[model samples]
Target: MQNDLVSIITPSYNSEKFIAKTIESIINQTCENWEMIIVDDCSPDNSNEIIENYMQKEKRIKLIKLKKNSGPAIARNMAIEQAKGRFIAFLDADDIWLPEKLEKQLLFMKENDLSFTYSAYRLIDEEDNDLGVFIPPVLADYSSLLKTNFIGCLTAIYDTNKIGKMYMPNILKRQDYGLWLKILKQIKSTKGITEPLAIYRIRKNSVSSNKLKAAMYQWKIYREVEKLNIFQSMYYFMNYAYYGLKKY
Candidate 1:
């Protein structure tokens, strides 16, 4: 995986408070060959200015400003369309990666000859304080992922050369889960790295914090997108709720 260019997709929307730290984490990465495409979804705050400042300092970092306020899925799809790398990785503007995240994950993928892979992550608050909680890695196949999405978007990396470029379904939430299911359907399974490589920031009042809303979206994914039968949806949803409770 040496000399391989990894395309990093970051969707930003009023994330001015934490985007600099996110950019810094990528800059500090041990792997140097990467292109970070930060798609600004018509952010009303100074997020564009902050991203521009980083782009000025680092040529590898590029910015795509949307004319309208689209959701994260559309913003990420824009970056995916422009991605010109063998590997496509997702890193939200508020999340962070360790220095060795890229290098180690690439090596793991190469050694295993895997098309899709994800690592464990730590949950942090808005202030970036670790909550002393870590989500463990799981070797997930398509069926297992249908039951529960153990793959965190911040730590996911997939090979475009193997499965081609895949886009997230145009959903407000759980778009990452949809993309994972799409890729896993094509590959044997998505391997997991047991080490914590990324930090997932859980901001108060964010969509992720709304359990009821998230559950509704998960149902939509199962019934509408995946077209799972009613019984199958209930079975998977039960597992999802159980795993989610266990994570916390």
Candidate 2:
């Protein structure tokens, strides 16, 4: 396993407002040996142009433009297939990571011999102002994660050398949650680092901002994706609702 090479998968669509900062965060990482695979899902805006500009200067940054507008799941899957690093990390196009994020998290994983790991993250508004709220990390297994998705997509990293490359479900929303569940099923537990390492930008009009739509997808995940029984679905749904409300 080439422990030094970290492959970052980012799915971008119409993220021109925040994509440059996201790329700069990766470029400024304390750990130098990393490849960032950004898959553009046919954005109407010039998000791809910004990525192309970065690709010209940084050889580590690669951009894949999809002929059609596939969703984030498929875009991320495309990058995963092209990843050659020993460790796979996820960073959304609109989120920003700390300079030491990769360095510290990689050290934590190697020290603990962990295959899957996630860290805490801070919330940011559209204007890039810190909301002064943070999501603390927690150790998660398949059973516990069935109740709530504690691992933030921007802060999660899994080692392909240990668990192999796992892909997200084809579903639109909650695919990262599905990937975590899949990895947890194979490994015993996912370790948590409590320090906030990334900024998750929350847009007012984003799909995640719509509570009704997000709830529907969560239900679909439990019922269709996981195939949990109605009673089990309700049991987890209650916990999800409680935690979802409490997160803010």
Residue-wise C-alpha lDDT for candidate 1, range 76-111, written one tens digit per residue: 999999988889999999999999999999999999
Which residue segments of model 2 deviate by more than 4 Å? 1-3
Instruction: Give the range where candidate 2 is weakest over 10 consecutive residues by summed lDDT.
Output: 130-139
How big is the positional error of residue 126 in model 1, measured in Å on the Cα after superposition? 0.7
Over all chains combined, what TM-score does candidate 1 have?
0.96
lDDT of 2 by residue, 1-248 (tens): 35659999999999999999999999999899999999999899999899999999999999899999889999999999999999999999999999999999999998999999999898888998888656555678898898888888999999888889899999989999999999999996877998999989999987678989888999998999999999999999999999889985
Best by lDDT: 2
Mark the regions of model 1 whose C-alpha exceeds 4 Å error after superposition: 1-3
Estimated TM-score for each candidate: 0.96, 0.97
Cα error of candidate 2 at position 176, Å: 0.6
